[model samples]
Target: MTAWVRGRVQGVGFRWWTRARALELGLTGWAANLRDGRVEVVAEGPRESCEKLLAALRGGDTPGEVEGVVERWSDAKRSMVGFVEK
Candidate 1:
């Protein structure tokens, strides 16, 4: 799944937070900051895990405030080795 998280998402360790959360959930993909001041995350793993990540993103912790989350689901590609911040 790919998600674009909006609102106070940049410059606040949001990418690192996402990496940690995804790693904790044993997911593999990457998270990056977009030029439009959003965070783009791509993760692949168990469906449940991905959903959990999405939920966590919605309930963003300190240093970030998640105003909205736009998600797109696709066929899981086990190509990613580990979670990364880009």
Candidate 2:
């Protein structure tokens, strides 16, 4: 799953928070800051875990304001070891 989050997400530890959540969910992927002030999150794991992470991303419990989130689901391609922030 991939998610592009917009709003007050940059410079607000959103990536770190996302990493923590993803790790806690036993997902392996990364959360990165885009040049356009959005955060892109990628996760590979059980569908339930990925869905949970997506829910949290849009659940209004993040560090900053989340005005919008664009989500996409695709086949996992990476053999990631752990969740990271980039």
> Using Cα atoms with residue i matched to residue i, what is each candidate's TM-score against the true structure?
0.95, 0.96
Alpha-carbon lDDT, every model: 0.92, 0.95
The TM-score, computed over Cα atoms with residue i paired to residue i, of candidate 2 is 0.96
Best TM-score among the predictions, by candidate number: 2
Worst 10 residues of 2 by lDDT: 77-86
Give lDDT tens digits, candidate 1, residues 1-86.
Answer: 99999999899899998999999999999999999999999999999999999999987573578899999999987888999999
Per-residue error (Å), model 2, residue 11: 0.5
- Model 1 residue 34 CA deviation (Å) reads 0.5
TM-score of candidate 1 relative to the true fold: 0.95
Alpha-carbon RMSD of each model = 0.9, 0.7
| Tens-place lDDT digits, model 2, residues 27-57 | 9999999999999999999999999999999
The lDDT of model 2 is 0.95
**Top candidate by lDDT:** 2
